[model samples]
Every structure is written in C-alpha cells, then in structure tokens.
Target: MISTGEEVLHGDITDTNAAWLSRLFFEQGYALSRRTTVGDQLDGLAREIEHCSLTADIVVVNGGLGPTSDDLTAQAAAMAANTGLELSEHWVAEMEAKYARMGREMPETNLKQALLPQGAEILDNPVGTACGFVMRINRAIVLFTPGVPSEFKIMVQDQVLPYLKALFPSVVSQVCQRLYTFGLSESGISQTLSSLVVPEGVVIGYRSALPFIEVKVFAPQNCPNVSAFYRTIIEMLGDNVVGIGQPMLSEISGLLQENAMTVSVIEEFTGGALVNELHRDEACASLLKDGRFARDFAKTDKDLASLAEAHRRETNADVVLVVGGKRHEAVSVALAGKGAVWVQQVASKRQYSQSSYRTVIATLALDMLRRYLCGMPVFGHYESLSSLSSFSNERRTG
Candidate 1:
C-alpha cells in the first residue's frame, strides 16, 4: 500500500483511508500483508512501491493524485514500473465531457491527472476527474486511486473490488464471518477462547473496535465445519455478543423505535455521550426525550434512585437510563422501566479511556433497557444493586 501526503506524515491529517481499506479487504477474506506511507518525494514513493511489489501480490496506492504541484503518485508509480508517464487522450476527453456537464471548461492543470504509467489501464472515476489506474509490476498488481474520500470509496466499491475479485477469484471465494462483542474486556475474551482448540485451515483473530471486540474467522467457502466453529465462539461470548456485523449506536436506537418506546436519560458520569449516541438515528431521535446531564450528583445510592424515578415520572418516558460514579470509583448504571429499576456496576480500573469507558457505561445501560422491554432479564440477581422491588405489582424474574 502506498499512502502519500506531506500532511499525513506531519500529522496535519489522518490517514483514515488505510483503516477503511483494511476492513474492506478483510471483508473479502484478503488480509493486507503490509502498509507503507510516504510523502510526495518521488524517490521514496518509488522505493516503497518497488518493495511492496516484491513483498505482496497486490499493492494499493492511495492519495497524491490531484491537480496540484504536490500530486506525485502517478509519476512515482511510473518510476517504480521503469516506464515514463504518457497522456491518454481518452481520459482527457472524458474529463472534458465531465466538466462540460458542469458548465465549465477543463483546466490545464487537470491534464496531469490524465497522464498514466505506460501500459496502465484506466480505472474510471464517475465521481471525480482523478481517474485511477491499475498496472502490473513484477509479480504484483498496483492500483492508484484518488485522495478524496468520496472518490476513493466509490472507486473501490464500484471498480477496484470487482476487478480484484475477478483477478483473484480463489482469494475472494474464501468465507469470512465477524462477530461483534461488547462488555467483555480483550483479556477476558482471550481467556475465554484460550481453552478452545480451533480446526486446521480456519484462522481466528481478535480486533478491538472500541466498545466492541470483533472476533473474525476466515475459512474456505466450501468448509462444512464453519457452522460448528461459529457456534463455539457464540458459546464462549454468550450474552456479550452484540451482533454478527459491526455494532452501531443506531442499532439500540432502532430497537427503541421498533418497540415504539420513548427514553429519557439522566446522565451524571457519561457526560453527554449517551444522548449523542442515541441521536445518530433519526427514528431513534423521536424515541429520546428529556435528556439531561448532571456534572455533580448525590453520593448516596438512595438519593440517586429517587432522582432517577423523579426524572422518569417528569418526562413520562417509557424508559429512563442513568449513569454515575466518581473518577476513581466503580462506574454505576441504572435503568428504570415502568416501576421496576435495575442497576449494574463495573470497576473503573478496568476501563481504558474516559470516552470509551463512558461509552461502555452508556452501552450497558441501553442494553439493559432493551432487554427489560423485551421481557428478558436485565442482569443476573447477583449483579443487581437494588432488591426485586417495584411500585407496580410485576414480580421480578431471575
């Protein structure tokens, strides 16, 4: 991989494209062997490409394909392939037509974007003028794409993915499944899976995606034992498993919307992150009302419970979620449904970051509320702080 930009190297900009590409390839069961970054320097860029070509079967080059003086990926690619840059009239005309539709003439600087390495095939860009190119160098295939995220994403999804799939059908034919988990720490999860023996030819890897730890398995598409492999993982993860794909904050929000339930938040420890996460979905937005943040709160458990009940009654919400704790103490989360309340706490020492920790707290609170609405046990009796008591006559079940 070739990611070029002085801004990226200098930390003025983040290289999000690399992370996005990693997940994209992983989904197709192709693991990236290596990734290299270089500035707009011609010699360095050429050196990295040459090295990558020798090391991996495919090299993906992103960025530095603009109309500016610093845009040097095309020229660098030509140097690495030991060929000269040549202008393509077809691309020039394509750019001209694209600009014509916008009621403007093509600029001369954009002609640099039309230049491609000798014998390279144009990877058409419908969204932007910086059309990408693909070429073979030694034993590797190199693809150069635009730096703009929108252009890069479209090119990858529409052109690059299909091309790679066709060129390496066997690689793309492999089956991969990802299981997202929340609540469990990475070490805890590792310990849980450490005892299980995985079958040969099936690869299992764990990655931390913030509040969720993604358990990914790659097996041949024709493997009949894949179901058993996933079942073992599910058994180990248990209720901590959120879903099979990437876990989004909108999921919990969508659940509330589907249930036609309104929620109110009384946050003391999570700052406003819980509310912010809920607002990500518009349908979820309607399900949320009376969201408030308290910088300081009562230290006693009784006062906190009274405050949560009062907040729920004032808003007349179907569910009320509360999060509270001191910085050095255990983080506590409470959920109120109708007249019953459930609470759970975890040590703050195990948390990694302030933001991520607060996010986990919020996630736990929401998950509890979700289960409560579904008539599932919010938490085990041992984890519950308050006794099985409610203003309503509904008896708590284990």
Candidate 2:
C-alpha cells in the first residue's frame, strides 16, 4: 500500500499535485489504503506519518519542507521515527555554497533542510529550493517530496514514485471504458441490451433522464479483447451511444447546434432542463425564439382552454416541450418526461379541445401545434417521452 499525507494552511499552496500522485499510484495497481490531511501541527504530522508508514508499504508525504517556520514535515518525520535530526555535513555545506555562488547568502532557515535521519538517504531535488528524501520504517518506505505542485510533480516523477515502484510488486495493467447513451433509463437501457452480448469482462450501468442515459464499463487493465468488448457494446447500443466523456444531453445539444436547428419548450416538471440543455451553446440562443411555459397541475377544462389561448397569443412559440420532476416521484429518480410540442400554426387551425386536467389540455393544445414543428405522433400519458422526435402517434384522438 502507498499512503500519502499533506498539511494544508489557508493561503500558502494548493495540494492538487498530491492528489494526482495518488491517482498515479492507483492506476499502477498499488493499494492506496489511506489518505489523510493535517494542519501544520507537529504532533498531528508525527502521528499521521507514523501511522501511514507502519500501515502501508510506502508512505509518501508532501509539503512542509520549506524555509518557513510552518514547514514542519522534516521535523515531524524525524519525531515519528523517534530519531534526532542531524545536519548533513556535505549537504549543508553544498546548499550554502550554491546560494553564495548565486551572489546571495542563503537564508539561515534553509540550512534546516540539510538535516537527515540517521538511516534516511537524501532524494536529490534538481528543480527547486527544497530536497526530498526516503526512509524505511518497520519495513515500509516513506518518501517525502516538496509541497509546491510543479516541484512536487518533478520530484515524484523523477525520484519518489519510481523508488517506491521499484520496492513494490508489479501489478497487472487494467482498462475500462465509460459508454454514454441517450433516450433511456438505467433499467430501460439495461433491458434494451438484455439480449445483447456484452462479454463477461465488460459490464454495463445506466443513469437516466427522459432524453439521455449513460452506460459505463469497467475491466482489468490490458484485458485482451477489451477493445472488441467496447466495440460490441457500442454496436449493440448504436445511436443510443452519446459518445464518451460528455453526457447524452450535452451531445444532443451539440448535434442541434451542428445541424442549425432551434428548439423551444413548454415548461413543466423538468423546469427548463431541456431548454437549458438545448441552449448549452451560446450560439444556440440566436436560433431559439421563445419557450411557452405553463408549469403546474392546477388546470381544469376551462383553465386549459384559457391557458392554451393565452399561450398562443403570447409566445408565438414554434415548439413547446414539458420536462422534469424530482427523482423517486417517477419511474427512475432522474426519469424526467417530455410531452408534446405545440406550434403556432396548429393553434390557429381552430379544432383543438380542452381536457379536465389542465396539464393534459395544455399538452393537447401543444400537440396540435407540434405537427408543424415536430411530426412525432401521439402523446399518451403512461408512455415516456425520452427523445425529441421519437414517439409515433397515428391515433389523433386524445
């Protein structure tokens, strides 16, 4: 196990380098058993270093090796090992002379870095003012590097981790792919591919919203046929695959922008999720004219007629959409819904009627309006609206 510890103070430096180092160890198959953070307190530092060094095969400590008084890593390490810090005869001399060679006297505090544990060997730092080192504690290697990210990265890349890897056993290479999909829930996506062959090593998982989904796979690094496994899964899921790294909604928004299409929506549960997604591209705002919004469950027959009439008169909206609700209230927690869209041309046709439920009446009015902007057929209550142009309704009766 490789353990890392750091001490953070408010305004000195950020510790992202430590986190990146931990990721490197994890990718290399080293068990990162523990990670801890401590303030610049010697007792806390001593306890953390001692505990980590004893528990892990290697304890990588970063930070506090500075000229400042708050930099107590070296002192804490010595204290943890119960060893006294003794100044290096050669190291102390060289650092002082090097600074003098640069036409400046080295700060007296910097002389502190010259100290060495009785059995510890200095790990040369070629890039910065601080020097890192490594030592053994109860059969574990404790590597210490600088706190500054640039210096720390350079030191670890060159000295620290390589030494730790040398002392540690080699692990198998592992690889996994995260596949993203659109238009299905986790269960729905899983069920769609239920008959598909995903291979034994490749697994699938789903995250759902009405128009989007994400499926990811994890497998052993360097697992042979991993590419084939990925390819097969991608083929099985086909267009549902929304590319990688980006989620489905993001991809769809990209597609909408690329195709030069505009999308307007009717606000309901999703509360602007779709409109917000569609307008992710700042350029898309130019294409989107306006959204017709009537967000509530409080519509009677008379209410629906008035709302639709008011909607048609106000926004001249080309397309209307309804989406979103809190998770758990629906089939899947994020399983937001999209209802029919109404176009201004249809509202003027003068044949749309109202329903007892104001929401239904509003959607019906929007569906009549939809035929001009979107040709997707039918808006049934139990049916899910997972895609922009997916549902086909031959039956016009609402």
Best by TM-score: 1
Residue 241 displacement in candidate 2 (angstroms):
4.4
| Candidate 1 segments whose C-alpha is farther than 4 A from its true place | 246-251, 295-299, 325-331, 344-347, 351-354, 380-398
lDDT tens readout by residue for model 2, 257-368: 5555554555554344445545655654565666544445323323333343344345554333433222222211111112322222111112212221223223333333
lDDT at position 316, candidate 1: 92
Local distance difference test scores for all models:
0.79, 0.55
Deviation in Å, model 1, residue 42 alpha carbon: 1.0
Q: TM-scores of all models?
A: 0.87, 0.52
Angstrom error of the Cα, residue 205, model 1: value is: 2.2
Q: For each predicted model, how many residue pairs clash, with residues at least 3 apart or on different chains?
A: 0, 16
